[model samples]
Target: MIFRNLNWTKNGLNINGENLNHLRFADDLILFSEDARTLEIMLQQLSDESVKAGLTMNPTKTKIMTNSQQIAHNELIIVNSEQLEYVKEYIYLGQLISTDGSMNKEIERRITNT
Candidate 1:
């Protein structure tokens, strides 16, 4: 609900019908796809849209993590580029979403504790 000007599109993929969206963000842009191929398509679409809108997609700031295990706040667990078995985690927004499917229970508890 942050980027009120951006549009929303239907993502025609499902893994157990979880609550999901193709793209979600407020001031910054966060895009999601069902798979790697779909993610590629989405990225291309983003590039095209940006071009048409006179906006720019910062490749330096843009990051792609394929085969995502799960997405909580916005972070991702992505396999390392150099190592196949190595996985890395990142945080997006203010929540911790892990590839292992863990939620920020402690943060939620703290918020409610007050």
Candidate 2:
């Protein structure tokens, strides 16, 4: 697989015994990896392939979020030499997801928007 790292050193979030590494919906994509190194490798490979297909990913538009405390705040992932931002919270599939994995913000957003 292009996205799967051969020597997997970490695992992503597992739900009901399923380890999810990525999710793609339409034009939106989310990558999951417990190891920062693995995530970076996947992202680099994706960026390279996208370039080969005549697509350029906007580094400014890309964001990274991590729930693990092991990941340092300064650990920013760069694509095409531009650094991506690390966000504490962001909306995914119209639902707010926080790096801390809190649902409070999403709940409040739903209440106000509903």
Candidate 3:
């Protein structure tokens, strides 16, 4: 999701499928999917979108985690040092709360979506 004042002039990434969720505020984009294959495809599409938008997805800053028990190391959240579990809130200053109270005013101010 986009944050701060960074300009995301490029077009946002668009993926098609059922039960897929995507959030884009500026350059910061977050997506979620239930199916494994769909998630994989979405990531691929994200890479393409990054290229097309002239935005670079920093490999070192990116993290991919799987929730399935069979999937090893399923706890990383890309571009963020904090664990996925810690991201239970996304505070948006002066805005309505969204999704499980993740939208905290302090958190939104701290969120630096480059």
Give the candidate number with the greatest lDDT: 2
Candidate models: Cα lDDT each = 0.50, 0.76, 0.46
101 in model 2: Cα distance from truth in Å? 2.0
| Candidate 1 accuracy as TM-score | 0.51
Worst 10 residues of 1 by lDDT: 77-86
Tens digits of per-residue lDDT, candidate 3, 1-114, equal 212232322322334533335666655556565544454555555665666667666654444433345434443433322332322233333343344444465465548542
Model 1 Cα shift for residue 74 (angstroms): 22
TM-score attained by model 3: 0.41
In candidate 1, residue 84 scores what lDDT?
Answer: 18
- Cα lDDT tens digits for candidate 1, 1-114: 223333434543555765244545554655666655455555666566666778766654566554445433244323222111223444567554455555676477558878
User: Model 1, which residues run further than 4 Å from truth?
Assistant: 1-12, 15-20, 66-87, 104-114
**Ordered list by TM-score, greatest first:** 2, 1, 3
> How far in Å is the alpha carbon of 24 misplaced in model 2?
0.5
Tens-place lDDT digits, model 2, residues 34-68: 76777887788778777776776777667888888
Model 1 / residue 108 / CA error / Å = 12
Question: How do these models rank on lDDT, best leading?
Answer: 2, 1, 3
